[model samples]
Target chain A: MSEQGPAFDLSYVANLARLELSEEDVAMFEPQLQGILSYMEKLDAIDVSGIEPTAHANPVLNVTRPDEVCPSLPVEEALRNAPKSANDQFVVPKVVE
Target chain B: MSLASQTIKGLQTLLEKKEIQPKEIIDSVAEAAAVRDGAIGGYLGLDQELAHRDAEEISGGVLAGIPIGIKDLLNVKGQPCGCASKILSNYIAPYDATSIAKLRASGGIPFGRANMDEFAMGSSNENSSIKPVHNPWDLERIPGGSSGGSAAIVAADEAIAALGSDTGGSIRQPAAFCGCVGLKPTYGRVSRFGLTAFASSLDQIGPLTKTVEDAAILLGAISGGDKNDSTCLDESVPDYVADLQGDIKGMKLGMPKEFFGEGIDPAIRASVEEAAKQFESLGAEIVEVSLPHTEQAVAVYYIIATAEASANLARFDGVRYGYRAPDAENLGEQYAKSRAQGFGNEVKLRILLGTYVLSSGYYDAYYLRAQKLRTLIRQDFTSAFETVDAIIGPVSPIAPFKIGENASDPLAMYLADIYTISANLAGICGLSLPCGYMTPSDGQRELPIGLQILGAPFDEGKVLKLGHNFEQSTEWHQRRPSLG
Candidate 1:
């Protein structure tokens, strides 16, 4: 219930998300982060004792269609959309280098 | 040549009868756009050549040869889909959104791309990095957003109808503010394959049109299973147009007391009450209903939505696609600098809050709890539906506020979405239809107000039928903004 709950530590979350947070952003976000977490704590008091967890409100039925391969946009048309490309693959900065 | 005053249905009738050719309609629509769009700023981009070509190819449908605006968030192949952000300024869609494809199949001419809040983050269209879209009713005011341009374009008759995406009231709020009809179809009812995700769990592509029937026809054409979207349901897509006039003679309508309580404009309350009386005159029963957890909808919605948005937008790290900063020394700096420079203030705030909530210790306390509240909120609707066929309320607390009035305060912007966000969170169908207008005590001018109708999951027909019935009993939808 305290503002100092889980949302305060940005580094822990940044680690989980594989994001590296700057010191400036972490300092700036602390209070705003605390405000959101405290608001969420209000939900902790609600009772759901025998209620079944529903992932989707609408009834979930399998939406299976015949496994048929369909034609896709021609490679030229597809590649025409790439901002930067070499050969047939999208060109990106080398991560390993 | 004043096609600005004509409804989509009226224009369609003219085209079918050959009284006016598609080229003539496009010409008139173009002229209207030139005259009115400058004041309203509804369009982000207008493709006259593409529109003329599509107009020539129009064969038949309820929307035959109708010039329709597409929200910038929806992919329209070969067109810039900037999403009203400088970050995406150079991004052109490689393919059309599924709904856009359906519109083309039905002979809808894509006229232009409408402006929106950047990445669909804000309730006011002012969040758009491009020129702000003004309310056609009053140029000094805002058109409710992130679907503001779509609603304003239809309101100003710049286009016959526009495709809008509703994630937490984006379509309906703008429709309400701009004095038009907008429908948010049930989740997974329409394909979301090409939509730029804001909050995936809440997003549904819907229609912003001049009338309820147009909304229904548009919904019928777009709603169905798509192999590209796994969330799409396999349920049978009923002909919404065919079911438009079904009898709701004795159906029960729930009037939630909480929605009509304090903070709602008195004029809006009167307007909705009058609409309820009209529904009763049509033999429908008005039953008072309680959605006990209604007050908590906004609080729960923000937490869950931002969490989902954080996850969805994580892909835009300037790595695989989109704009990357050129001066970065390493990958880490590249992502940070790119996202920081690319995203707008509101977008950045949400991303920060989302990352905070979903972070290690916070995930259990904030994200998990919010998900559980979402269940309770859905349950409230489930139980309420047992007593009534539909629920009614004001689409927003007040008519469109003056432009720039709420831009500085983020909380004020979020408050405008209070009444409309719950339906999206609960994954149900809802519609906003013009009911009446708000005339201040000083009597300067009357601004429009809307009556929102919400129905059970996949009950769009019932929602549309009720909305159509209400429109039939009132002249609100027929009244156009005086832009001349």
Candidate 2:
């Protein structure tokens, strides 16, 4: 928490979130970044003794239905709603060179 | 009958008598939407053809042929689920959300999708990428968000009832602002399958209705076990409708001291106190209860919510489905450009905060500690329930602030959800119903204020009974937003 995260280098966050924040946004968000960090710092005051951490509030149990396959949306009907598609598959720009 | 005055039960009664056909109800609702929705911005999109078709198919159920609005965050098969964001502008859902399926099975007419904050992230509806939903009471004020549209539509009588999701006061706060009944069911009461995730652990699908009885009927229809969502409880969902008229006599009600303390607007505070008096008049015992951890609720909520949000939103990369930016040179750039171009400022802020807190080095000090505090907060409620059957508080510190009042300051906007979010975080059932109106000291207009009733885990019956008793004694819920 010590090292001042790069003034404009949210490239690390961008990499982690697969997001591309503009250089302008990174500059704007820099000052406010510390406020969020400080807000999280307030949690350090709470004392947790003999407390078991809970991930989900309800008791965990497997919710399974019978293994019967239900009919799916037809390919043509499903693809009809897609913005761009070809050969019954969603069309996308070429990725691999 | 005018669509505005017909409750879900009233409509069902008319339908049973064949005095009003389902088609007539659909047409009346469509007419109301056209007249009222333009001013309020309650709907993102409306499907007249599908709605009519659904109404025509209505045969028998509790809410048969009753038109309902789905929050844009929930999936409706083949409809554009914008989630009020530009990122998924053209994304159409391939499946109906589990709650929607339940509503359909129970004969609900899916009239339209309601607007919400982009991805259920903000308190005011201003965060919506598409359009801000205005309060029907005063067009200049907000209707509250991310469930703002759901609340507004129900308040304005554009829909008899609407389904909404609460991550952190998304349902209750908006319901309070719009002067309607909103319930955030016990976390696992409703399944989360196909409701677009904001904070998976905290989000619960519930209803916004004109009356507590309608809310009870809607919750009964939609809640139960779901195979698709593993987090949903397997326990039998009790007949909430049967318990709607339960005796409130001799029931113990706790009034949390912190909730009604300073910082609460005097007018709103008076409204809650008056509501407690009404409960006492109804023969329920009112006792002062203290939740010492009340001040830490907001900080604890942000940390835990953002951490879960960071993990849940990781699925929105430009991969399997949803928005993908065009003209990216590589896979990495594609993922980055798609999200960056797609998400709004608030959504990005949460994602960044979520990712930062959950990051490897800071995980223990930030995320882990927040999780530990969450347990303590839950225990605070559990211990208080030992002394009282239910806890009551002011739903929000103030009545609906003007639209742009807190938009600039994120902290001010976060504080608006202060009293309501803890119920979501603790995974308990809570409902907000109109208690009275308030006129601010600055000569600002009077708006509706709500009293929040929270019950023990899976104890919605107690909360509903208390709300029902209050509604029977007072005429607050009877007052409609002056849309004219």
Candidate 3:
């Protein structure tokens, strides 16, 4: 990191995002991402010693519903768009040894 | 005028008189789509059979017999809700979005899948993996997006009206580019239940139509409390149609100097200033105001929007739904490879940006700072609204640029949304309507210019009334592009 800004480490962020970028993708995105990050640095000029953060401006607060059991989407409908599903369950690759 | 190009109110009137049938309107839209869609590419797919089937049963509602173009992200049961991303290309919605249910309740048939930026990530439609939507005004120019197709379809008369969601100017910018009316209600004014999440804090679904009254009619149908979305306001929905008929005799409109000054093209600045004069002629007083923090809005938006987007978009992991990579040896490979292979360049980039901003150590620097600045932006609106009924400005700083001209520069593209993005940050209602035209020296066709109208939170009625008065005094709303 320098006075200009922290250098954007493409591989580190891509791994965090769970995206497998190839040489072509890296070549394409690196400079563009750098430019965007630098553009964001302009926000640092404003001094905010005691300002509160706003997640959103909508006035609504916490909402709740009754605890009654309700009918939900059928297994058949829920699994309809899955790439691989069988016996009302989604199939996936195993991660652990 | 052709039935396809007629306003929703115009068509509704004809249907009431028995001068035209419900099926005729659907057929007219289909005919228009057939003739122009090859050039416009606004729709990814149209459900003509389903639309016609619903048209048969259409009766006794404000939108009765009218077909509305559905942006691909909205879940309309049995229709493919692709979001213009390759990952969701094969996914069919199992249920209707709350807004779609309300539309159908009002007899509006959800007709087609309009293309958009994959996950609504970009300001230009070029980010769409399915296909880029072209502005109907000029074939080579880029249509503003991520709701580009929604605006283009309504402008080209392929559909009477369409629904669009705005995170940061997705709906209004495109509407300005394509010469249509786009209204983004205050956050939580409309439910986000079946609408795919982009940025939860800023996302809202609204209408793109040919006239201000048409926007009001469509807004009335989709608004109200929805139990499905907790953030959705339980407040009463006003009669926007009645509001449209009210006079705008002495309303004060704030014109922010930040929007009218440098960075905006001189020609666009002149057109917007001229539009301000027209507002005065219609008995409204224009007062100059300053939103000093306007410059930092775009910077804050990318951080906050992308941070939320990272969390929201992590659901597309190929385990439950959407495109999945085959032959992955392990779960890690499956997650990474499927996303890398299925998602487009822009979507991948935004996800990475979001992930970086929200990463452990950097969160305080990027995401937290943006939130505090967002408070400042919202306060700017709060102070401005105390003295004025609404704020007026330009939608985009320049005419729609050529395809690929600004796509490579993400910052440049994001800056184009400068005027429209602050309202989303502030969570206030904003509308973009055709104000004037720009006759470019490079092209023979005139480009449409839009003036943005901003109102206090949940104050859409006042915005509509002001737009309606300006619309009535001018002939801009009546101007249509000739596909020929």
**Is candidate 2 or 3 superior in TM-score?**
3
In candidate 1, the residue pairs with backbone N, CA or C atoms under 3 Å apart (3 or more residues apart, or in different chains) clash, namely: none
- Please give the lDDT score at residue B65 for candidate 3: 83
lDDT of 3 by residue, B309-375 (tens): 9889899989999989886888888889999988998888889889999998889989999999999
For model 3 chain B, give the 10-residue run with minimal summed lDDT: B53-62
RMSD after CA superposition, every candidate: 2.6, 2.2, 1.1
Error of 1 at B429 (Å): 0.6
Candidate 2 positional error at B182, Å: 0.3
The order of the candidates by DockQ, greatest first, is 3, 2, 1
In DockQ, how does model 2 score against the reference complex?
A: 0.50
The docking category that best describes candidate 3 is high
Scored on chain A only, each candidate's TM-score is 0.71, 0.72, 0.89
lDDT of candidate 1 over B291-318, digit per residue (tens):
8877777777888788888899887776
Q: In model 2 chain B, which range of ten residues has the least summed lDDT?
A: B438-447
* Residue pairs in clash, model 3: none
Fnat scores for every prediction: 0.19, 0.51, 0.90
CA lDDT of every candidate: 0.82, 0.85, 0.91
Which residue segments of model 2 deviate by more than 4 Å? A1-9, A62-97, B442-444
lDDT of 3 at B16: 89
lDDT of 2 by residue, A1-97 (tens): 4444323235686578787888787865555665656655666667766667766666576556788999877898777555468888876567767
